[model samples]
Target: MKLHVCLSALLAVMASGQGVQAATPDAYRDLNHNGRRDVYEDAGQSIDARVDDLVRQMTLEEKVGAMMHGSLPAGDELGHGGAIYDLDQVGVMIGERHLNSFITRLVVAPRRLAEQNNEVQRLAEQTRLGIPVTISTDPRNHFQAVLGASTAGGGFSLWPETLGLAATGDADLVRRFGEVAHREYRAVGIQMALSPQADLASEPRWPRVTATFGSDPADVSRMVQAYVEGFQGGTDGVRPDGVATVVKHWVGYGAEPEGFDGHNIYGRVARLDNASFAEHVAAFDGAFAAGVAGVMPTYPILEGVSLDGAPLEPVAAGFNRQLLTDLLRDQKGFKGLVLSDWAITNNCDAACRAPTADHPQTAKDIGMPWGVEGLTQPERFAKGVTAGIDQFGGVNDGAMLLQAVRDGQVPAARLDEAVRRIMTLKFQLGLFDNPYVDPDVAERVVGDPQSRAQADLAQRRAQVVLEDGGRPLTAEGVKTVWLYNVDPEEARRRGWAVASDPAQADLALVRVNAPFERLHPHHFFGARQNEGRLDFRDGDADYEAVKQARAARRSVVAVNLDRPAILTNIRDKTDVLIATFGASDAAVLDVATGQARGEGRLPFELPSSMAAVEAQDPARPDDSAAPLYPRGYGRGAPRN
Candidate 1:
């Protein structure tokens, strides 16, 4: 299992005079099992020296394997939802292919998750180079569970969605949230976070708005910077204890035409004009300023964007050199790894390109080649590498990339450069020193009492009170409350009597989600995504519940604003209207009962009508001609 670099290779690296220092006696892991301490194994060496040493020892196959960030397959590949990794598959990926990084999709308890990651690291320790695996994950500290967008909080402390964080308008709170999330993630052996999305929520209809800070570029920038600082443990680059963050959907991914997402073939183009596009790019300034370790290119192809008065290439951000190289790296001075969005290099076959009712699209059928569909797999690899992408996400086909390098499609120097960046991060993260986490400590740290208390308080403070026309919810006169879409136990716990029927209660409370359409039921992500309409019409079940509550008594209605819904109709039905990003039934009830502060402002405008929403520009913020409530509007008290 030991694979040591020859003495000649070490001597050659030393002769090159790249980060070479006098070899000193130091405690080391002997990762290469070379019978003596090597430069990379020495903890005393600089991260740059260690990266250079490691990269020099890596073969072409190993280097290519380093560039592919694949998923940790479950025991049953067909049903891998929140399942533990299959050790057999893990061995094939790590031992045979030399892959040392993976995205863990397991949604088990904190202790079990930590134990599983430790097991994977043990297998990696037995490998040739003994490079520990760096496990990464999507946002898993929130309530939303849109398959590819975010995961549900299982044992982690549950916070409001990113939009809810924006609603609080507190950068410090957002930073605290990141700190808590980082502690929980690292407790379970996750070294990287694929989150803190800096994309502006400009397009209200976009399904991923819930994951963003808000629609304002400046606000998003401020929050994004705090998020990075909190997660990375400082205002500088990632520290040894910090989790490396990957701020995502670089540039303008929120400007999808008609609110369609790029995760599906039909929604691959992000319509961005030159002026509006600049605003979208400005949103990521905070992440850049915070020295984030990684950036993920958006999946959509920029439609109307240009560079220096010339039309740019009509391709996705991952395959666009103008965007990645010129704008991000050269102009913005981003010296970090550029990870492509998932499956950008895979071929879009008939099933992926067009799924029918008979063959509904599944996760396996996803492949987002976009404008580069005509390119071969090897050609796609070459194009992405030249475009400045350091790693291909959601794919483990390093053989294809290796072939491209051998065929002269990708330069060996460029491949080496990418390998250096990847290795540098791993060294900086202290993954080489120790990648295993304590399972017992993980159970004690993840979702501890103190963290949950803070999270619950955050949930209460993040609720936006749009209107309070009826008697104040704090009034002691109200006793018997009728609940719809709320747990009766929560009301009972508040010492309030819960009425079985709406008519028998003194007041009624209702909860509903902003209306959405299953527009693309046949597509994988499209089916899971909450797309299309943001209006709440009469016939809808949620709207009916509101109507029934209003008819019974003064109703206090709270709606989950995952998308900026047109509340002109619902506004008239209920006496009180409140907006929430993501909160538990108890948290909402606490806010409603004046037990906690609920002064959060609207992060985005609620359009007055569907006409205003459709007529508005997707890339512009708060541009609705007539909005029911403008951004930053919220009432802290009951209205007269």
Candidate 2:
């Protein structure tokens, strides 16, 4: 036993050093100074050649490690979410795994940013292949903290949500927005963004609708293409330092029955049939045409198909062979990487379990099952890989996966295939050659003035015009009244009159809660009474408060502080409703002052009531009764 343990340790050490000595000095040269390798430079036959050479030098264990993407725990000790950002974690994971590619959940920070870049560089040096790690992030150009914020929470630049961008109908502005995000990402060592959510807002109550471009399929497609072009710079090829866009939720995740959180739940089944699938598939088709670098599968299943037509019920798309191999790769011709959503492998069983404090029962009513415990993490991972998930996002079971392979649950060849796909993406990203960023260039590009100006312009264009008594609220006629839900400091900074009571105001402006429903005793009161009453109404108090104010002959405007869908419930109560989608105190104030016109429209339909939302078809387009106000229905001028 002692001899075997010693031999294993020796083998591990040798494996770690195997690819390091093979790296050529030319790999360090960024000939174009673009923070990436120049394919034309004589580093090797091509970036592909270098990638193949390095991949060949790696051991099977290293290859398997490469497929696992890991994130650090967000404890209070690290400040708010953590000092160890997702990019930093990705860097560490790459070094530990000897993998060139990974994903991150990082929110960009301008200060102490150099340290973040240095950590990634250090990790790249540790790997034998010297492959730079590609860190991915959520949409960060906004001020909302849905996914949580960093240590200096308020420092990040706030941009208008995608809902607003869609209303502009300007592909150029959307493209420029992507470019700005690309610049910010490059500064912080993020190479991929799991964004440009192309899913058409088919359901009005879907919580994530604000993340998308409004309800129009064509508009969604155009905006996605523009975003992809802006992030990658050119459709023909990726820019040297440009961030790769991951057009996501591959299928109609947004159309899940009743506009729920998860793709599948016990009550919420697939409402989309063949025709519905075709309409929603158009946006993904457009993303593929744009040559997007990555695609993420939704956790929901299509009703009919299976891995091998085994009659699998609620087929997990992340691990479903028919969907990933047959549809995505073959039919759609997506040559880029396909990543699973965060812990999607465990979603099937997890969805079955009761909702947690973080997730809440409201998500369950929408088909997001809170908790179920059937499949283990290893089982999910193996299944996902067989189905063609190239990389694991928010993976927690790397060691378990290694154990599963040793136990013969996962085949070595399958693991190799996953590793190859990841490595190929790294090579395609040109990380094998130029993996370092110039601190000077990063500093200059970090939150560039031009990008901020573009964000401000985009924010202004995204504003939707609201009217009172048939008169549009123009800048001259607008008398702003700001209502604070949490604190008035941010709202008061804009010099608007902060109202303590809505009765005294011309416009009853209330900052509604971000649509997060907590399943406390009060929330579960109706759930205990009847299963039908399980759904929790989000922002109920705020909605009723605003409604009361509107009934008192005041022009009311309610701004959604989170995902814009929550605005649907209060649409009828107000003369003008603005789905600001995300919180940007400055941008919100600008819109209120008429300095920035309201250009945003509903990405999702505004459901008439909670019961109506629960009864609506998840897969079908929102063909419900005309919302008290339609998607494009907003006041063209300020109301008196």
Candidate 3:
């Protein structure tokens, strides 16, 4: 794996001579235009030597371009509640930015995604150095069914969300999912996965619980190790067959101040004291053990937090050298890419707000350079670099990077260090040899039938039943079922009779989501996805809907707990109570009818009431209010 280039290839590259020789009309000779074969172009050298050679050859502009990773011109995909939407902002990030990496979204067709990625690679190849672009993406194959957060499988095999995966509690199954995700991603030219968040879900009211593994340190730790192992094929470094992982929020983000989200300024720190830090860092410790390829810092303030007596200024992790360099790299011995969360280096003035028209509660538009608000953009970049961050997400500009170097604010050696890490990934992924993807292979592999079936099995394993209510859930005599929010056609497909009206059915199957009361509930209306929070205010529409359905007939209520929710409003209003972390309708139906029994357990506790949630210590883990259902409480059986 260490060897890359051959002597014959080097001779072929070197024979072109100086001044860029021309060959074969359309094909230009000396693709790198260096006239002589550079050490970087030779795959026969060690990775460190190759990185050093590439760094030496790069000018300031090229080096800056290598550091930036910008947004791609999003193509047609299910945007904002299944609508035909794309990132319509017209910018020259590609032609002008010249960044070697891109953060992309899923396209409606897998082939089109691969084709567009190939086109981006072509764009990058046109540069002087000809570095192949590495496409990075958020989690796209999960079944969370959100708009801004995730896509609708988009023809890729859909597996349970991370919460669902944790629910299953099967480390091997998680590893298998990593294998599937890597295969599908590579087929479409996606080399990086900005996911597998190692953060805990200790705070029940946290909004991003849909993305976290679980609350318990032990359970989350197992999943984190297995997931990285699966994606990296148990290798300590990046591989051609592997899709490198970016384990996120580096420190725990579950215990947000007052249970609010950290993407915005109001809730910036994981308020927990230094004593409770171990549980927060538990899964990350496991990620370190699993040898993850990259780490993403959270957008939260850690004013009073520190490791090994190192003094940390009250600021976001991205700008803290003590936290990043002293703690993560030196103390913990992490050898991976350190990436900042999106829009962190920019300023967050009043006018510089995040996008809130769609997913209101989680929008983060303004810059979040918490402790270094006094510094200029170039100064901020210099600080992050000095803090041990390898790359800056959300923006792909090198003006600040170049200026930092010119001002003597950042050393050239630091730039080389960052570029070396970046170059290693590009070389290790085998992007230097062949970067373009074949659309045909993408079409077949993105959702291979075998992978899809395995995903379905994982889905089945993740469904959890809390209370059966002394009722035989899947009685043979129960034929007609009324569905509220549950798809009628899907129920009929599952061999059950579907009735539109509750009064006209044998049993009413009401599928309602967990209650969420956002802090600001305005400017969010039509064509938008649901927001996250645990408060179910009295007379809420969703709660009222379930109550009405239950009154109409003897109903079975299943709550989709994207995050740990407060179910006091509708807990006693139904016959059977089921908690689904993130599973398919078919999986839910199978579990309901006893066709497939759930083997999963609750990963977090459901709060008894909003009052209980509000009274708990926001600075501590597993210190929530009285629980309606505690963690690891799956009654009767744990069957797949």
Candidate 4:
């Protein structure tokens, strides 16, 4: 139980430069002589020995480091291509700090693919345990990158966004999509995927709903199961080739008022009543039943109860004992690893300073007791560990966590449990057995043509069919027009007429990106107040396009590429309000042509106005606000 004892053993063996051979019980064994530890084989004795050996070799600090999950910001300097932690920093963490797991924001773009691949390999080499750093990412196979966001990453295969995949309601398709995703991820050395946001799209306006499967619990459940099964393949409770799926925001995260992200609530009350909670729980429950490898908690408070009934007031589910231990572990029987959302440890004041552009300042302003002002770095880290968060994600304060453990604020025994869970997952992933990707096979496997085909199929399947004036919209007869907020190049490639002047087109398609300011408001206080209001009347670029179309005597077809609820503002001006959810040019075109039916219903109710959203109760049981369209409201029309 003393974490340092295990680390001393590991350091003694590894420091001697003697590679472990002939795996014993609890250790990974190459049963097939393939040099990869195949967990599927009956190598239990070896597996147990490896597990024991690993535990014995880990130091308290190393064990704690194993439990700490961090982020790799994909900035140009970091070598991946975005902004956050870079590759060199990642190398330092693994080489010096001995950290392993990381959740990455490096969307699989073509430019940085080589660099990222090299970095993963390098990180593996740096670790004395031969533990390959597991790379995790958000959903990327579709067109739903942040609207107006830079399309810098290499466009990988385009699958149906979560909603589109859900519309198919075909578990097999979902599974196949997951399988394809696994192939792509493994090709790129990605070990884990923070995907298939199992949160039901219960509220339409929620900014992240586009990433969800759908509104109905049943549909969401099936899709969740299929996603897990596909991502973590094998009927034998182990996926040999796929990345592990992390089911997220356990219980009622999707039910936030108007489906907003990260809003707090008092007591263990859910925005939806018990009935709705049951439905939501069913979806997450199904994912657990399907045997996902990880679970993540949202930043919201459930009812008045912090996860563990901790007296600290509104403890984040990430550090809530009741939520993680009582519900997720005990009741739901989730035995996998538990990960904290990014910077949950920074909830304390030392690391929780006023938000910069990188961090949301509004989190501090929200008067939530758990804000950076009240929580210290050590406090946040201790709270998270005690609350049963096995891994720290997007960790900006790894040094603080290390220091806290050294000071004994966090128990060494607890740290080992976390490390054990993490190593177990790595073992389950067969990482020890197959730490290296075949460089020759990398190109073939990374972006396979078949996977691309699957993506294309998903894109087509995900298309939403919209009708204007009782007639299905078709490209043949209609003067296909592209309006508001699309990359001009994308519009042109799709064969749609990109109109600078709204008056010239018969149908005006307006695309709206979710205002990032809305998600992270403090950074743009004055600018946000003036422009961040979700009102369609606000002079948003997309809003202006719709108004222009209305003035031109043209029938407007509005396609909201972000959240579906943005359609409420221009519902009156639009001849057809098509919520493609996310931007997939192919899917958008297909939806326009009626080749794909709009099966996606509003996941959350669209508030009538900004006031309705502001005044809405976060703890309210009902979300019956007047939506442009209700949940499950879809029009079926014959394909043109």
**C-alpha lDDT score of every prediction, in listed order:** 0.84, 0.58, 0.71, 0.59
What clash pairs does model 3 have? Answer: 4-43, 5-43, 5-44, 268-301, 303-314, 354-365
58-88 per-residue lDDT for model 4 (tens digits):
6766776677676564563222456334667
**Which RMSD values do the candidates have, in order?**
5.4, 8.4, 6.0, 7.4
* Candidate 2 residue-wise lDDT at 640: 34
lDDT of the structure predicted as candidate 2: 0.58
> lDDT winner among the candidates?
1
lDDT, model 2, position 35? 54
Summing lDDT over every window of 10 consecutive residues in candidate 1, give the lowest-scoring window: 11-20
Model 1, 1-640: lDDT tens per residue? 3323442233222211011122224334667777776788777888888888888888888889989888888754521564577888888888888788788778889888888887898788787678888889999999988777777755999999999999999999999999998988888889899988999888899999999998989999999999999898899889878889999989799998788999889889988799999999999999999999999999999988898887879999999999999999999999998988889987777877788999887767789998999999999999999999999898755888888999999989999989888888888777776666767678888898999999998898899988887455563567889999999998888778998788887778899998999998988888888998999887999998998897656678999999999888888888888899999998887777667768698998899988888899998888889798999888872233
lDDT of 1 at 637: 29
Estimate TM-scores for all models. 0.95, 0.78, 0.88, 0.78
Q: What is the lDDT of residue 32 in candidate 4?
A: 30
Q: State residue 428's C-alpha deviation in candidate 1, in Å.
A: 1.0
